[model samples]
Target: MARFTTSTLSKYLLQAQVAAQALHTETAPVPPEVHVPLRKQLKDEAKKQKAAGKKKKKNANNQVVDGWELTVGIEIHAQLNTAKKLFSAATTSFNDDPNTRVAFFDLAIPGSQPIFQKETLIPALRAALALNCQVQTVSRFDRKHYFHWDQPSGYQITQYYEPFARDGSITLQARDGIAAEDGDGVMIGIKQVQVEQDTAKTLAQPGGVHWLDFNRVGAPLIEIITLPEIHHPATAAALVRKVQILLSAVDSCVSGMEAGGLRADVNVSVRRGDDPSAPLGQRTEIKNLSSFKAVEDAIIAERDRQIAVLETGGVIEGETRGWSIGSTETRRLRGKEGEVDYRYMPDPDLAPLVIGDDLVSHLRESMGQLPDVEVDVLIKEFELTPKDALSLTALDGGMRVEYFWNVADALAARLGLDRIENLACFQLAANWILHELGRLTSERSEAASEELGFTEDGQCERLPVEQLADILFYLHTRKITAKIAKELLWVVFRGTIPEKYPSVLGAIEEENLWFDELSETEYAELADEAVEGQEDVVRQFVDYKQYPQGKLMFLVGRMIRLGPEERIDPKNAERVMRAALPEKYVPALKASD
Candidate 1:
């Protein structure tokens, strides 16, 4: 029942050991009912002790809550995709050969020097600009002292006091039914965004010793903190996903939860608004939420835990907690650390980042259509639904939206139609990408026998986007049936272009053009051969035409199936079957015919 910090938990465990000696001698292991009541008493005592400790540290000037308002904020760390470290020339690649990428400056040896990499700084600026932040012309870095084996520097060089940007806002659309609407629209807000440096990774070992990998040290990192505008766990998850998309759109940040490029620190606090003077309860910070689902789960569990504490007239302590994904519970790590003087000052070794007028103009000019702009354009120009546009532009990989539109435009041209100009093509493209191409690629990636690099060009065993798009478009235009198109697409992806048409179309044309290449006599002979192959069905159809409509269609189906390499007109086969039927059977076959 007691809310304790990691340090406090250790103390309590030590105290409990001393107290247990006396209690064990005075009491005996008893019946279940007695033990239950005794445990409850001990829990109540613990809760009292926890509340008394928290009350001593309460700040009187902090905001008071009545009961209904819940405050939520997020700290997002997005890794920048720069070739070098922010403050050092060390390579900023992930999962590299351990400490090999570390430069002397990164290692922080005595008399070691530091040099700011413009490559990293520019991308960080671009990201801040994309986030709608006011870029600071002069920013400074400071040494944040922390003890960790991986941090050979004994401190992390990061921008804390004067960040590259501040007061930025990102607009995100909440899922329907998540947020309350004002008249007709829902509202979201952003707090701020700051730039920082990433820490080294700690690889776990069996005996609690971790192998330090400094490859990630000094990597440029941007932290985008949001206002507690989010009302639900689901909404928080959604906002994180939207931020990922926005970061990815700028091409400065590599945003992926699985790849450790994006991570979130979720802060959850609960309040009761019914009482006007009720205190705003303590908040718990859930650290390192790597995935969106983990963010949601941690928030939900923290919220519930805080609510229970308040209901029992207890207090929640402000502390950092770790989320256990396997158990879906939050364990207190440490109490909030007091703010330290970072001793922030401009680096004498590196020049201040000055944003000239011309550079700003060029950057603005080079900025392509951003995700939000693309979403709006897709809806207005292409007449797509908001949901559809969002999905098309929200992917984390490749030029999905552009590629989709390009292929859609190409198909429209082939059909002698104008560009989408309406929602029809947008809807069609969404369905094709999500249901067919996306599904196929995901499945194939999972099934690969070896390392199948998605970004590799002309990989012998990889699928091509062009080939997939062509097949889908062909099927969309009714140039091939669903079944035939699927088969042909598989063949094309496997690096084999069927010899029907010159390519996919040629293969499709081969099916229909088989009859064109043959003489009339030859075509007639082929039809006779098809009939002879299904003599049993033919005799039954000749005897009882009405009873074998399905059988007749099956027989015609087989004729096409058998001569897949040879073109046969499905319409002509039906005509020939009707003509070959006996006179007595013809009258009864009218309905099926």
Candidate 2:
């Protein structure tokens, strides 16, 4: 049998088309009888599938049943956030018209040579250092030859033999969406990280015609390979998310799975038994999973598929497959390609990439703080709850984290205290930013996009940091009650720029929303006035003793209504009301108090 690779398949299709066209010129027309049976067979199969869809179907058990063990390793190709193509000076763009961003070198025009872009190395180095990988002093590129419409050059330039970095690791914390069975945390090893060129996108139209978009060709990419250390499907998903977070934190890659900034290729295999020495089953590679959920579901579906094949005394083919979200199954794409099929060779155009230790040190110093480190600082130094820390850091690619820090620091400055000395301010800032403003922003972001505006990354600009700090400052200083402060927050959230009024304090003063700074004597007078009118409520409290606390609260509400303009603090009103209560109605106080 002829071995059919991608290159061979394209040639075969072309040759067969030529032969068919020539034969059609010389041969007589076929009879209708030749086509009727095939049409009938397809229609019958469609009817059967349609009928089966109407019945309630049990979800296939994806659990690795009894004695099976599964392992998964992920390969991620993340497009670096750079302005130009890896080898050409053609600008990179996601929304540009197709074929417009291509350079002569990108299109493999005659005599066009590859020129390495030194700017690409800074981000690549930051990523390697963030992942704890050892940077190699020298790395070289290789040409992996294959034929597909996506590759105009007919080969991909990659770092296969000497990747720039290796032996990194990332820990999957239990709190970071890993399953409990995976233990507190699992440290997964990074096999290597390499720089590569991306191929053009292939969009398949009807009738087997594939359109090539070269806007993506020769764009810089970093391929992160991991050892097959994952045992469960959820863990694999968590690992991918960890990589996304780390890459985004360092400003190396946006890692936006939906926008094609990041794509994962998962290799999954299963075997029977718990022995470490057991021979592994033939593994199938699932290509181009675009979402975290797809990463998990594809692994489970592939694992179950392999187990089924093995249990039926059948062989699992080592092939490439595509994931079907609709059926939740893996569909075969092609048999796997091995090293010989790729025909890897050193690129004749580019020389070895050499880096000095000083450059690596500079990148390491210039790297932004990672998310985990920021999470720890939020929890320890800032005294935020662990839950709030994670939520704050995870929002909008850590833009919220920056907003929170600014608010917290400004509050401390206004209060004339160190942040550590005023834990209440940090806690208050976290509560409002994470819960109140966080929710308000999320709910109104779409409707108020123009009013709220957005950062360069498209995150809704959080309520300005100074305005939030002013509100917190007033509440801290007892100038405004929490209730009035919340009202102030809502006012500022709905496009009310408190800074225009000079500050939140200025807004409060200008709007007459400040809490009444009344004395205890004034509160007692109001409480007395409250009891004089509501005789029935007072009777229930003093004589009938029916729901005494509720009746007393009713009196407090009455007193508050009388002074609505005062913005009366509810706690002070309730306290003064209890004190002004008729002695007969006074509940016995605890001796301990």
Candidate 3:
């Protein structure tokens, strides 16, 4: 029946911890920086008596079926990909040796003072604007007092009392199979976005030793907190991914969870009772979830765990839990602390941050086309389906936007902007990019990352927009079939263009010619060869009229693949093949149409 929210439950524990501090010789008034280990150890030992190793309740796996209202909120810490740290001149480079990238101010050395970096505000402003947040005219820095192994300065410089932006919203695009949970047009409210400095990296050794690396000490970070409106795990994951893409587009963060630069903290609570307006249950905080998928899984695991506790007549304890990848369960990390425990105060070293109309307007005009704008253009103007448009932008973020832009540019060049404004040309370009280029390019990216040592973001190094444009233009103008377009995109990505595809000049006759430059005569020859030897199909087509249009397409498509990689325009080939199917068999094409 004991609950953490009631101070009476933890009174003696706090008293004992305070009394025990005097026995240690680690210096009384211990800077709060050196006493983190003892506090962590105390929190650990206390959880052992509270059923630490108990498995999740198998009987109450269905939270919804068992009548529970689950509420979830997400907190994302995005490490801005900036040139320098937020409050120091230290370079924000990852993978550097431990303690090497630290600036003098990062260590709080003598005569050191925090110098605010104005350039670091660009990405933060861009991200805030993209999310529809109201940028504050003035914000301030607050020192968050804490004692952790990773934080050597005994506190973190953050936006505690006031943040850069607030009261924003993100409109979830229609269910496009990517994240079906956050359905169409659902607008998730943004609480606030705060710019802060990251802590150092803590490396755990084998024998209970922890080494602190100061390389990440002063790195700039932005925390995007959402209002507690999420009810499903899939929706939570969707919001996380959308924010990640938005950050990547604005150069706010690399958004890579594996690199430890981007992480998420999920807060979940479940309500079950006869009353609909009962006070919200005590929320458990899940710490440091990295992947988007992991966010979904951890939310579901913790939600069920909360329900399991409630159904068993057990009070839900307000605490922090860590998601375990190996066990697929949430393990207790430590007792949760209220806002008062952090002792937030105005930081003396730094002054209040102020932005004017000119600064806000500069960042506003500097932002490129956002996802919503791109989707509207792709759908309303280009006449693409909502699914295809969302797929192009959401799946790969900035790179996909760039790729589609190149496709549009190539189309405009080939057909002129006025002519390419029609639905057919735009739809062709969209479909080819989403279905064909999307699949093959992903494979190429993986290969490049493994073989060429390219960064995850740099996997598109070989994908020159001009070269990709060449392939897309062919499909847009009906100059080549989708099959030929795919082949051209793959070959062009791998090597030089305007040359024979095969390595041996004469070993396999001549190499395949590029689709864009193929002659019309070549298309006719390929079509003639397709229906040349099929007599039975020809009889059925002319005399009996047995097969349907679907059957005809299947046979013709298969026949097209038998020949060399010539510039055989599929539309031209289909027309010519039907034209040569004798005058009587023409009704199969016309009537079907």
The lDDT values for all models are: 0.63, 0.77, 0.68
Residue lDDT tens for model 2, 516-562? 66688787777777777455565565445355898778888888887
Cα TM-score per model:
0.70, 0.76, 0.72
**How many angstroms is residue 497 displaced in model 3 relative to the true structure, after the best TM-score fit?**
2.6
Number of clashes recorded per candidate: 13, 0, 0
lDDT of 1 by residue, 1-593 (tens): 33435465345333333333332442322212112232344357557766666322121222223345566789889998788887877788764555556655554544657777777766667777777777776777666777666566667776666776777776655432133322223345555566667886665544443445556777888888777666566667777877777777777786577567899998888887676467655678899987776776677767767877888989778788998542235899988655434555554555556666676567667867778788878777777777767777775353666666666665666656777543465466667654555555563554434322343122223444555556766656545655676677566655567433457666666555222333445445555566664545655765553677787687566556656433455766655555655543344445455
Judged by lDDT relative to the true structure, which candidate is superior, 1 or 2? 2
- Ranking the candidates on TM-score from highest down gives 2, 3, 1
lDDT of 1 at 17: 31
Q: After superposition, which runs of candidate 1 have C-alpha atoms over 4 Å from their true positions?
A: 1-67, 175-189, 275-279, 337-351, 380-387, 396-398, 421-426, 444-470, 498-501, 511-593
In model 1, where is the ten-residue run with the lowest total lDDT? 55-64
Worst 10-residue lDDT window for candidate 2 reads: 29-38
Give the runs in model 3 whose Cα sits over 4 Å from its true position. Answer: 1-66, 176-183, 256-259, 337-340, 394-399, 417-420, 431-447, 450-466, 475-484, 498-593
Over the stretch 491-510, how does candidate 3's per-residue lDDT look in tens digits? 65566553554331121225
| Residue-level error in angstroms, candidate 2, position 44 | 29
Better of 2 and 3 by lDDT: 2
